[model samples]
Structures are given as C-alpha cells and as structure tokens.
Target: MAVWDFAMPSPLHLCRAFHNSWASWTASEARLRIATSASDTTPLPAEAIHAPPLPPPVDTVYCSTDAGFSGPDRSPTFGFYVRSMDGAFVAAASGPLACPYDPLLAEAMAIHEALSWLQEHNYHNVQILSDCAVLVASFRDAGSYRSYLGIVLDSCLRLINSFPACSVKFVRRGSNLVAHALAKHVSAVEARTVWRDSLPPFISPAMI
Candidate 1:
C-alpha cells in the first residue's frame, strides 16, 4: 500500500491524487484502507467542519445597467451584460450618449439594448438582473410607469413578454459593478447603436 500525502489545495487536484492512489494500489499486492489516526479522532474546528456554501451556480445570466453624465448635467452612458452559469459571455449592450438627464431613461435604454441583443440571438429563458429598482418595479406593477417612462416601460414589458420564461430581478448596487463598468466604457468610446457578444479584456477577469 502506498501512503499518499493529503492537504491538496484544490478539489480537482485531490480527485486526481486519489484516483492515482487507487490505481497504484490495484497494481500492488497490498490492499489499502483509509483509516484516521488516533489523534484524528479529535473534533475538527468549526470552520474546518463546516465549509462555506458556494454561491448558487446559475445557468443564470447577469445584466447590469449604469448611467453617466456627459457634462456633469446630461447623463450620457448606459451599459448592460448577460453571462452564462460558468460566467461565460452571452450577450451585452450599451447605449452611449443617451443625453437623457433622467437616470431611469438611461436605465431603460440599457434594458432595451440588452433585450434586443438577446432577441437577435433567440434567447428566451432568461433572468434579467439589474440594480435599478424603479425599472424592475415597473415590470412588477403596471402603475410604475408614468409620462415618458410609460413609453419606455411599455417597450420593456413587450420585450420581456415575447420570451416564454423571463424575469427581471433587482440586486444590490454592489453586485452590479460589471454592468456599470460597461456603461462607462460605452460613454468613453461614444459608441453608437448596440454592442453584443464581445467582452472587454478587463471584464473577463472577474468572470468565473
């Protein structure tokens, strides 16, 4: 029997190590038994006994929208993202130079861009994530839209309804950095029309 060292740093590494050990045992005449030593009978520390639960992996996509001002008064940029469960890029968008002082309008434009990008690729079952409460709430209640926002709200609703199983969820602002960053990029580049699929090199780092 071969005595293998424990304390590997990664689960994948540990799996490979154990598989190799088992193979080695099979080739040898001796049998292998995984028994703990007497000192190992002591209870593990609380942190060791209970591993932190990982964030739920989602086939899940994330989208974020951000608003920026062109001249400290006119908000010009809006950006959004859509990612797969392993955080691979799916769809993304930005509406640069919106020139709308109303942040909600900028947010709506970003949402519209994201939806249009998704629709082009025929993505139906999706969960649109955002940090904009007003925009998300508008989807939940018919009354959330009023005046100009009413038009934007109506457009968003129509886009969402076109898909069979789609939902808009509001996450905390802290969780929406990716989308917000895209929006800023849009403004800086002054991009016209919509962007899709391609992601900036910097954004890929945070991705799983």
Candidate 2:
C-alpha cells in the first residue's frame, strides 16, 4: 500500500491559478455586458410605432355652381353658393339665362354668372367649383371659343382675369347639392336673384 501525502502548492502555481481565475471572471463579465447592450437595442413591435402629424388646412374660400335645364324652349337657370374656408355659407345666387337655351352653354353661363357676381362683390381670392367637368376643363386649359357661346366664354374669361386670385375646379354632383337644389328651385324664374349673408329656404336643408 502506498501512502498519500497532502502538500501546500508553490507560490508560482498559486499565481498561475489566480491569473486563470481572473481571466475567466473578466471573460464572463464581458459576455454579460454584450448581452445587456444587445437587449437594450432590440427593435420595437410594429404597433408601437407612431405616425407623423397631418398638415394644416388651407386658407381659402369655396364657391360651387350648377345649372338646371328643363326644355329647349324653357330658359335654363343657374345657382351658385360661396362658402368660407370652414364651409360656412357666405352668399348664394340663382337666376334664368338671358341667352338662348343650350345645356353646355348654360353650364358655361352659370360659371360666368357666378364669377361676375363675385367680381361685383369685390371678392378677389376665389375658388370656383362646378359640377360641369367640360366647363371646368375649358377654363383650366384657357381655350378660345369660336361657337355661338364663344362670346359668353370670353366674358367669363374676362371676369376671371379681373380677379387677383381665381381658380376653377370640378366637383362631384353630390357635393354640389345646395347649388343643384337652388337651380332646380329657380328654374321658373325670369330674372336674377341673389342672397347675401342668408340662404333661401329651399336650399337650407341641402346646405347641411
């Protein structure tokens, strides 16, 4: 049987053991720091994101126009309404055409009437909206007219040029309900009628 003796380690062996232990502890600490940094930088879920804000509303008035034609012999009537930027009714006008009856001509005349009315009221900055797409397109393209209605278009262009700021736009029929209602209500009229700071009872419901 061989006898086993327990002995204390030499200083050199102790120093080597201490160095190895310190290196192992430092490596473990560095790994922990890296893991913590990666967790902190993780991306958030899609639902946690936020969207940018919308821009503010524009500062401008809106005027909508429409025309109603009953028959070839009957005169066509037009209606127009001006609203503030916030859509509060500013003024309204409706009347029968003094010119010969034609649907396209009636639409152009309607716009002319509205522009003339605004010009008379000293409204420089104005935006004209119509349910008639062709009329709006003609005005946008600044086309010259040669037909019987050429004079009427020229008059409308002159009125538009008088304004310091003016624009013509085409809108959906549903959006021009008030103007349509006014046109239909005044189809029997033989003269021009205007309402300022007040709306007619017939178009009151449609204003909503």
Candidate 3:
C-alpha cells in the first residue's frame, strides 16, 4: 500500500492523481494524437465535413414605361428603357402614335415590346423592375384585365410567359428618369427610335 500525504501534496502528487483517473479511460495513442492536434492549427485529415453548394446569385433588369400625354385631342406617346443588372445602359425604344388608349394600356404595350426583344435576343432568367404597379399586378393576376384591354394584354402575357422566367416589379417615377425623358422626347416630336449597341450621348452617363 502507498501512503499519500494530502496536506503537503506537491506538483507530482496532482499529476499522479489526474493520470490515475484518466489513464485507463483513454488509450495512450488517443492521448498522444489529441496533444499533437491541439498544437497544430490544421485539423486532422479525416475530420473535415463537406458542405453542399449554394445557388447562383439573382440577376435583375430595371425597365420603365413612360406614357407622354398631350392635350385632349392628341394620342399619348410611349417610351421605355431597359437597364442592365448593374444599372448600366442596355437599350431604349420609343414611338409616337394617336390611339384611344389609356396610360395603363400604353405601359403594358411598352413592357410587351421590351419583353419581346428580350425573348427574341435570347435573354433568360431575369427580374423586371417597372414603375407601373397596376400593370405588373395585372400580369400576375393574368385573368382580370378589362375586356377592351384584351388584345394587348393577351399579346403581352404571351410574350412574358414565353421567357425562361421573368418577374415584374414597380419602382419610383423619379428612378425612371431615362424612360421618362425618352417619352417626353417622343411626345414633343412625331418620330420613333430604337437604340441598341449604344445610347445617345445625353442619356448615356445616367444609365451607366
């Protein structure tokens, strides 16, 4: 039998106490491995757990329709701008016409043209930002448009659905300056223009 002194125990005494308790519980190899791992910043080779991949980031295209209204006798002109995902200049289109159409209808038609171009040019997986909440909501609802709006709405819906997938959102009018400026230009004149590859000098800086 070993006689142990408790009141005057030294450092060796405490070490022996810990060893007696843990020596039988853990294998000597495990203890050595734990010590080696604790001193190293790199973990053990087999300890790493694999993680699943994440989804790709979303892309957005901001578009706005501006219906330029003149006096009672004139037909309102329509213009639109499509900005790239990072707000860079993409393209713009505008036209002047005399039709007994409401602003909502004109907005819908402008969106229709933009989407048509997108489909024709093979742009897929996009979110559309607009300033016409009602027009967007109408597209989402799909079945509640008024009877007189049937032709244009149907054409627009078909064009929209033909995409890989597109989302419609409304933004502030102030944020839609490029399209509004184009609409103002079309309203004051009697011409139509479709811009691609580059934008006119005046509207280029703001778009970028």
Candidate 4:
C-alpha cells in the first residue's frame, strides 16, 4: 500500500487573499465617491441662476412717462410713450413745460399730460408707469396737495378718474429708458414734438 500526505492552505496565505479582496473593494468605493463629488461641485451658468423674472402678460395698454428738469427754477420737459401689451408702440409725445417747476411738480405734469393724451386718443384701459416713487405714492394715497404742485396733482387726480380703467405704477429708471430719453430730447429742443405712429430714431433703440 502507498502512503498519502494531505496539506491545507497556510494561515498567512489565507490572510493575504482576504486583504487583496478588501483593498480592491475599497479602491472602487473611493473612485465612486470622487466622481460623485466632482459632479456635486460643478458650477451652474450665471443666467440660469441670476436672470430677472419677466413681467406678467397684460390685457391693457401701457405707457411710460418721465420728466427732465434742468434746475428747480428752469423749465421742465415731459415725455411719454404708449405701447400695447405686446410691446407695439402706439404714440409718443415730448414737450417743454410752459413754466419752470420743481421736480415733483414736473413729474406730476408729465403724468397729467400722458393721461390727457390717452384720453384724447380714446384709450380707456391704460396702465401708466413712472420712475418717480413719490408721484406713485401720492396717487395711491389721494391725499391733499399744496402750492403749485397741489394744483398739478389735483388735475392729475381728475384726469385719472376719467378713465374707465387706469393704473399708475412705479418702475425702475432702466425700464423707463425710452421715456427718459424722450424727456432728455425735449429738454434740449425748443418745440413740442408728437409722434402718433412712429418714434424718432434716437429714441427707437430704447423701445421695448
């Protein structure tokens, strides 16, 4: 009969095999985490996060008005531009006031002139925008007025009441660029100009 010998794997070899398996799994896990971290830290585009919200749609015509005053004692100029809800220009007017007035009075005069123009054109549903916050506040308050400004404010209130549907709102100067430009132009000119269906080339770029 022949003798047979049996041998088992050494403890050290078993431990080495286990260690290799564990190390491979740990490396794979680390790589996955690094990929995840890279994706998580990526930056987003500026416009995606910082863009301004668009204005809501409207059913009524909108007009932007502004006034330019050279000084408290100098003649003021008024400018206004009317457009449809979809941004189609309807009319524009700019002229120097017959008398010199303070800033507040000038703004009130501009608002009054714009409302009168709208009434003349039979525009009932109108939304007026101005960059003067005080004027808007006064309209909202319907409070008492004093001095020359008081008379102008009273006229503005009366004109506002005539409209079947009218709204006055405050907007930033940037959004009132067209009207501001028109006011500036009128301040430099001696005659009053009215554009019923078109805008001057200088003010066209500011529209819409």
Candidate 5:
C-alpha cells in the first residue's frame, strides 16, 4: 500500500480539523473555475476586463446585493439592484448560483455576479453595497489571501480595480431589503429574474 493511504484521515477528522483551523475567519468567498476556463483568474474574465481611460465620478450609481438559500444543500441565490444617482431604480436581477457554496462563499458569489452585471452594462462608476461586512472587508486584504476563498476575492478585487471609480461598501440589513427580497424570492422559486424599467409589485413594498 502507498504510505499516504495508510495515514489518510477520516472524513470526520478532516472536517473537524478544517473547521477548527478556519473557525476564526468566516467562509464568505470561494474560488471557482468553469470547465472551459484557461486559468483560475480567467474564470471571472479578469484578463479581458479593461477600465476606461477616464472613468466617471464615484457614486454615479448605487448597487446592493444579498444572498438567499432555499435549503442547506441547495445552491444559494443572489439578487442585486441598481439605482441612479438620485435613487431611481435602474435595474434589478435575481438568480440561483451556478454551484453549491457555503453561505459565506455564496454571498461572495453574489458580489461577484452583481459586479459582472454592472460591468457588462458599462456601469464603471457604480458603487456596490453588501450586507455581509466580512466579505466587504475581504477586498482590503485579498492580495494576501491564499485559500479557495482568496482566489474568489482576488478576482473580485481585480474586477473592482478595473473600474476607475467603482467600489464595494458594507450596507446595513435595513438598507438592503430590496436585494434581500429579490434573493429570497428567487431561492423560493428556484429560478431567476431580471427587471429593467418596470418592476413587479411585490418589489415595491421592499423598496419602501
């Protein structure tokens, strides 16, 4: 038998060790690579992302994100809302994530997806808000993160830096109710939504 096989740890033992080692830090983000990805960073389009030579002023728009899970084993869903500088709703979306991720990593994925949505629409000056304080703080030290979550966060940072005026800020739960509602509804329906110009009535109460 191989030497490693003789000393392999049990699943329970490994889980316990991992939990203990990372107990102090929450797991809000995790690395992900698509089947066709050329590299880890490429999974997030980092290579092709380019910032405008002269970007708009900060807070040209505002975006908020939240994650909701229908069950412990199911992938989490995420929702995001974009608003004009004066707080008029511009767009909103909610959808299930591509892969099953822990709650924290799911929240990170929510941030990533929301960023992707904004960038795709050329919103370079939009500011992102997340209720998860830990994930928001991860942006500051992403360079030093080497774990799976680090990979996800580093990609997020790269995307954020690609925009000359974009930033991610921590938002309180009360302010993120719309995003939370969007995500929660998607999780319940196990589907996705995209709202632009007109929104569903169910969303109005949450907006208030």
Candidate 6:
C-alpha cells in the first residue's frame, strides 16, 4: 500500500470529499427507500377485501339477470345465469324478445323467463339478482304496477311465489355483468341458447 498522501489531500479536500461521499450515500439510501416503497405500494384507492355474500340456505340456487339492447328501437336480448349457493355453475339461459320492449319491461321479462326455466327444472329453492332498478321497483314500489310493464312484473312475482323458496332482489350493475355478457352473446347469435354443463366462452371471466 502507498503511504498516506497527506500533502496532496489537505484538510479542505478531505473534508470536501467526506461531505460529498456522505451526501451521495444519503441520496443513495433515500433513492433505495423510494424505490422499495414504490415497488411495495398498492394501487391507489387500495381496494378493500370484502367479505363474500353469506351462503344461502341449503339447496338454494343463485341467479342473475340482465337485458342487452342492440340498437335504438330494436329488439332486446335477455340473459340469466344460475349457480349453486356454493358458486358452482348450475345453468344459464338467454333469448331474444319476440317483440322489442323497453328496458324496464325487458328486464322484467328476463326475470320472468329465468324464473320459468328454474321452475320447469324443479329448482324450487332459488335466489335471483336483477340490476334493473325499474323492474325491481315494480316489485318493491307498489305504485309502479299501474303500467303495462306490470304484466311482466306480475308474472315474475307469481312465478317467484310459486317456488317453495325464492327471492328476487336488486343488486348493483357490476354484480350482474355475467348476465349482461350472456345477453350480448345471445344478441350476437340472435337465438335462444341454454347451457346445462359448460357455459359459453364469453362467460369465462365470471368463472375466474
């Protein structure tokens, strides 16, 4: 090793060098911490993990319904998806209306069709979710039954009452996207489709 160059590196240079090194080290540590914090950060408005919906009573089937409208004044498609209370795929069905109906009536029609299918298949224990505020309102708000759409709502309620155990309730639109996608599928095909085993590829995302 060479002898200490005391003359070359005077007190001023040594002090300057030490100060520079300390600053660089502090900056490096700060940068490291910043990078570590960035890498570990969760997305903004970090989503809270929510408790799952409570499991329904034994042997209950869960169903969701949505209506898809193709274009202005054109026919609408109705879609419904069914799953066991355990969230296993039970069945799915979709069909286009014989005649184009408004959103409220169309959604009520969707529930009517879905309940009919469930009843036919002997699925007496059923819980249905619909994202149609108007249709659900018809059931909840008695005043809404005055219109012609009330016909479909009455039919749906009649079917619901016939079941040994059944409920039709409203949920947020996001919770019913599977049925919305199914409606799109049928609208594309322009025909009725039913799934007893595997569902359509379009619905795979909901499975995940």
CA-lDDT, candidates in order: 0.68, 0.79, 0.69, 0.82, 0.78, 0.80
TM-scores of the models, in the given order? 0.61, 0.66, 0.62, 0.67, 0.67, 0.67
lDDT winner, 3 or 4 = 4
TM-score of model 5 (CA atoms): 0.67
Q: Candidate 6 residues 1-208, lDDT tens each?
A: 2246654566787789889999999999999999999999976543445545665679998999988777555668888999887788889888887545577777878888899999999987898899877667678754457776767777777898999888878899888888888887734337888989977777776432
Q: In candidate 4, which residue pairs get closer than 3 Å at backbone N, Cα or C atoms, i.e. clash?
A: none
User: Distance (Å) between predicted and true CA of 42, model 6?
Assistant: 52
lDDT of 5 by residue, 1-208 (tens): 2247569777898889889878644433222234334463433465456644755474588889988886656657888888887878789889888645577778888889888888888877878999999888878888777776787888788788887688889989999998888888844346677889765567876464
Best-to-worst TM-score order? 6, 5, 4, 2, 3, 1
Please report the TM-score between candidate 3 and the true structure. 0.62
Can you tell me which runs of candidate 5 are displaced by over 4 Å? Answer: 1-59, 187-189
Error of 6 at 104 (Å): 0.4
Q: How well does candidate 4 match the true structure in TM-score terms?
A: 0.67
Model 2 local distance difference test score: 0.79
- The window of 10 residues in a row where model 3 has the poorest summed lDDT is 47-56
Q: Which candidate comes out best when scored by lDDT?
A: 4
Better of 3 and 6 by TM-score: 6
Clashing pairs in 6: none
Error (Å) of candidate 5 at residue 144 is: 3.4
Rank by lDDT (best first): 4, 6, 2, 5, 3, 1
